[model samples]
Target: MTDVRILGTGAYVPERVVSNDEVAAAAGVDDAWITAKTGIRERRWAAGDQATSDLAAAAGRAALRSAGLTAEDLSVIVVATSTPDRPQPPTAAYVQQRLGATGAAAFDVNAVCSGTVFALSAAEGVLGRTGGHALVIGADVYSRILNRADRRTVILFGDGAGAVVLGASGGQGPRVRHVALHSFGDLSGLIEVPAGGSRMPVDETVLDEGLQYFTMDGRGVRDFVGDHLPRLVKGFLHDCGVTPDDIAHFVPHQANGVMLDSVFAGLDLPRATMHRTLTHYGNTGAASLPITLDSAARAGAFTPGDLILMAGFGGGMAAGFALVEW
Candidate 1:
C-alpha cells in the first residue's frame, strides 16, 4: 500500500510584526486586557502591496526546496484560503504559475479556520486515488477585508502562509490514518464576511454597511468551543480506533488562547499535551493549524510512531479532525 508522507514543510510570515501595543493604539484597547483575553502578544501582517498569492508562493517555494524537489515534480496543488487575490482566479493557479509548475491541477478551498485540515483530507483522498504527490498550502491576507475601525475583528487577524509537501511513499513512511470533516451551515451566521459572496456582492450598500469586514458573534464562538471541541476530538479518536491516551499531541486551530485552554480543561488533558502557536501568530484563519504543525515539527516535537490528533473549528460553522502517525 502506498502511503502519503509529509516530505517537507515550510512557512512564511511577513517581516513586519504588529505588537499588541500597536493594535491597542489603533483600537482604543489596553494591551493587558487583550493579552489576558486572547494570549496574543503580536502577529505578522503583509505589506500593503502583498496579496495572499504572494505568501502562498513563498511558502510553496520553501516547501519544494525543503523536499529537494522543484515545482515540476508536483502533481497537484491545493490552496486553502478565504482571501484570494481576486474573487475568481482560485489563487492556487497563481501560486502554481509563480512556482513554474506545469500540468498540475490546482484549486482553492474554503472552510474558514478549518480550511487546512479540510484541504489536507482532500489532498490525502486525491493521493489515495491517484498515488501522486500533492502540495497543500494555507495562506490568508485577512487584513484586506477587515474593518480597521473595529478593533474586535482587526486585532484578531494577521497574514501568513504555510505549506506541506505530501508525496507517495513506501509503506514505511507515515500516512494519514483516518480523517473526518463536518459543517453546520445552519450556524454559519456565527462568523462571516457578509458582502463578498454571491449572496451580497460588493456594492455601494455593502461599502456603506462595512459588510466586507469580518464579523463574529464572540459569544457564539465561545459557546461552540466550550461545548463542541472536546466532543469532536473524542469522536474522531474513537472513529480512528484510538484513545486520548494514545495521542502524542493535539494540534488544534490556533484561534485564541482562551478557547484552547478551555478545551484542555474540558478534556481534562494536561496543557502540555496540546501544541499551540496563537501567542505569536494570533489567528491566521486557514493557515493557523498547518503553521502550528510546521513550527512544532521544526522544533523537534515529534517522534517516530507517535499518534497525533489534529482538529479545527471555524466559520461555515465548520469542524474537522484527523489522526496520523508521525
Candidate 2:
C-alpha cells in the first residue's frame, strides 16, 4: 500500500480585524470582559466583496507553490467549508476553475469545524486507491453569516482559508495512523446558523428576528466540551496505543479560549504541547485546524518523526481526532 503524505500547506485570512471593543460596541458587552473570558483581542473579517472561494483559491495557489507543483499535477480538489460562496454547485468546482485545474474531480465537504479532517479523509482515500495527488482547502467567511449585533456568535468567528496538497508516497510518508470520529445529532441545535437555508429564507420575518445570522448556545457548547472532549481524546489515544507523553503536539480546532482550555484541562494535556490560533484569528470554523497545521509547519514546530494529534468539534455536535506521524 502506498503511504499518503501532505506535501505542502498554506493559509490566508482577510485584512480586516474586528477588535473586541468594536464587537462589544455593537452588542451588550465590554472589551475587558470579552477579553478576560475568551482571550480574543481581534479577529479578521473578509471584505463584503470577498467570498469563501476567493480565499480558498489564494490558499490553494500557495499550497501548490509550496509543494513545488502546479495546478495540473492534481487529480482532485476537495474544499471543506460551511460558508461556501453559494448553496449550490460545490465550491470545489469554482476553486478548480480558478486554479486552472484541468480534468480534476472537485467537490465540497461539510463537517463544520471538523471539515478539514473530513476532507483530508476523502483525499487520503483517493490517494490510497488511485495513487494520485489531491488538493484540499478549508475556507470560511463566517462573518458573512453573523449578526453584527450579536456578540455571542460574532465575536467567536472570523474569515480565513487553509490548504494542503497531499500525494501518494512510498513507505516514508506522512501517515494518518489512527482516527476516531463521532457525532451526536441530538445536540446539533446547540451550535448552528438557524436561517437562510431551504428551511428558512430571507423573508421580512427572518430579517426582523435576526434569523439570518449565526446563533449559538454558548453555555451548552461549553458544557458539551467540558464533558465530552477529554473522554474522546483519551479514547482516541488509547485506541491508537499511544500515550499523552508520546504526542509532540496537540492541535485542536480554533474555537475559542474557553473551549480550548476545557479540552486541554480535561485531557490533562501539558500546556506546552498545545498549539493555538484562536488568539490570532478567533474561530475560522472548518478552516481552523488546517490553518494551524500550515502555520506550525512553517514555524519549524514539527520534526520528521514527531507525533501530532489533530482534533476538532463543532456544529454537528460532531467531533473527530486523528493521529499523524510527521
Candidate 3:
C-alpha cells in the first residue's frame, strides 16, 4: 500500500485587516466585547475583486514551492470552500486556471468548517491511487456571505486560505497515518446560509429577509462540540496507538476561542500541545486547520517524527480528525 504524506503547507490571508473596533461598530458592540466573547482581535477580509479561488491559488503556489513542485506536477486539485467565484463552475476550476495546474481533476468540498479535512481525505485517496502529488486547498471568502450588522455571526468569521501538498511518501514531512470523519446531518440547521441554494433560490424575498447571509446557532454549536470533540480526539488517538499526551501538536479548527476552551476543558490533554491562530484570524471556516498548521510549521514548532493531530468541527454539523506522523 502506498503511504500518503503531506510534503508542504502554505497559507494566505487578505491584506485588508478589519479590527474588532471596526466590526464592532457595524455590529453595534464594543471592541472589548467582541474580544472577550470570541478572543478575536482582528481578521482579514478579501477585497471585492478577490474570490475563494484567488486565495486558493496563492496558497497553492506557496505550497508547491515549499514542496519543490509546480502546478504541472499535480495530479489533482481539491478545494474546500463554502464561498466560490460563482455557483455554476466549481471553485477548483478557477483555482486551476490561476495556478496553471492544467489537466488535474478539480472540484470543491462543502463540509463548512470541516472542509479542508474533507479535501485532504480526497487528495489522500487520489494520491494513494495515482502515486502523484495532489494540492488540497481550503479557501473561503466568508466576509462576502456574512451579514455585517449581525453581531452573533459577523463577529466570528474572516476570509483566508491554506493548502497542503500530499503525495506518495518519499520519507518527507508528515505521513498521513489516519483520517476519521463524521457528520450529524440532523444538526445541519445549527449553522447555515438559509437561502441561495436550489431549495431556497435567491430572490427579492430572500434578499429582503437577509436569507443569503450566513447564520449560526452559537450556543448549539458550542454544546455539540463540547459533547463530541473530546471523545473524537480520544478515539483518534486510541486508534493511532497513543494517548492524549502522545501527539506533539494538536491543530484544531479555529472556530472560536471560547468554544475551543470549552471543548478542551473536558479532554485530558497536555496544555502545551495545542496550537491556535484564531485570536488573529477568527473562525476561518475550512481554512482554519491548514492555516494554523502552516503557521506552526513556519514558526519552527514541528520536528520530524513528532505526532500531529488535526481535528475540525462545524456545519453538516461535521467533525473529523487526521493524525499525522511528522
Candidate 4:
C-alpha cells in the first residue's frame, strides 16, 4: 500500500484580538474568572468582511507555499467546518475558487470539532489511490454563530483556520499510519445550536429564544470526555501497534484548558509532550488540532522517527484519532 504523508501545514487566525476583558464584560463575568475557568487570555475574531472560506484560503495558500506546490497541483480540497459562509454552498467550494484549485474536487465535512482528523482521513484515502496532492482544511467562524452575552459558549470559542497538504509519501515530513473515528448520536444533545435546521427552522420565536446561538451542557460534555477520551486513546494506540510511550507528541482539540488538563492526566502518556494553543486561541472548533500542529511544526518541534498522536473530540459528541510517524 502506498503511504500518504503531510507535505506541509499552515494556520491562520484573524487579526482582531478579543481579550478576556472584552468577553468577560459581555458575559457578565470578570477576567480573572474567565482565565481561571478556561485558561484563555484572548482569542481572535474575524473581521466584518472575512468569512470561513477566506481564512481557509489563506491557510491553504500558506500550506501550498510550505509544500512548494501550487493550487493547480491539487486533486482534492476538503474543508471541515461547522460555521460555513452560507447554508447553500459548501465552504470548500468558495475556498477552492479563492485558491484557484480548479482541478481539485471540493467538498465540506461537518464533524464539528473533530473535523480536522476526519478531513485528513478522507484526504489521505483519496491521495493514496489517486497519487496526487490534496488540501485539507479545518475552519470555523464561531463568532458569527455565537451569542455575545452567553458566557457558557461565547467565551470559549474563537475564529481561525488550519490546513495541510498531503501527497504520496516521499520519506519527508510525517507519514500517516492510522486513523479512527467514532460518533455517539445518543449524546448529540449535549452540545447544539437549537434552531436554523429543518427540525427547527429559524422563526421569530426561535430568534427570541436565542435558539440559533451555540449552547452546551458544560458538565455533560466534561463527563463525556472524562468517560470516553482515555479509553479511546488507549484503544487507538493499541490498534496502531504502538504504546503510549512511543508517542513523542500529542495534540488534542483545544476545548477547555481545565478539561484538557484532566484528560491529559488520565491518558498516562508520560513521554508525550502535549501541545496546546488554546491559551492564545481558545477553542477554535474544527481548526484547533491542525492549528496547533502547524504551530508546533513551524517551531521546529518534530524530529525524524517521532510518533505524533492527534485526537479531536467535540459537539457531534464525536471523536477522531490519527497516528502520524514523523
Q: How many steric overlaps are in each model, in order?
A: 0, 0, 1, 0
CA lDDT, every prediction?
A: 0.85, 0.86, 0.89, 0.93
Query: What tens-digit string does per-residue lDDT give for candidate 3 at 130-232?
Result: 8788999989989998899999989989999999999885576688888999999999999999998899999999999999999999889988998888888
The best candidate by TM-score is: 4
Top candidate (lDDT)? 4
Q: Candidate 3 — which residues are off by over 4 angstroms?
A: none
- Residue clash pairs of candidate 4: none
List runs of model 1 lying over 4 Å from the truth.
270-272
Task: lDDT winner between 2 and 3, please give it.
Answer: 3
In the range 109-199, model 2's lDDT, one tens digit per residue, is 9989988888888888887877878999999999888887887887788899999998886555466786677888999999787887888
lDDT of 3 at 53: 90
lDDT for predicted candidate 3 compared with the true structure: 0.89
List RMSD in Å for every model shown.
Answer: 1.5, 1.6, 1.1, 0.9
Cα lDDT of model 4 by residue, 142-220, tens digit: 9998999989988899999999999975567789899999999999999998898899999999999889989999999
**TM-score of each candidate?**
0.96, 0.95, 0.98, 0.98
Residues 1-326 of candidate 1: C-alpha lDDT, one tens digit per residue: 34778888888988889898888876888789789988899999999889999999998888888777889888889999989899888999999899888968899999999998888888887887777688999999987887776777777888999988888764554567777999988899999988888989999988988888889888898898787887877787787887777888888888889878888778754423789887888899988877888898889998898887788889999998867788
The runs of at least 3 residues in candidate 2 whose Cα sits more than 4 Å from the true structure, single-residue gaps closed, are 171-173, 270-272
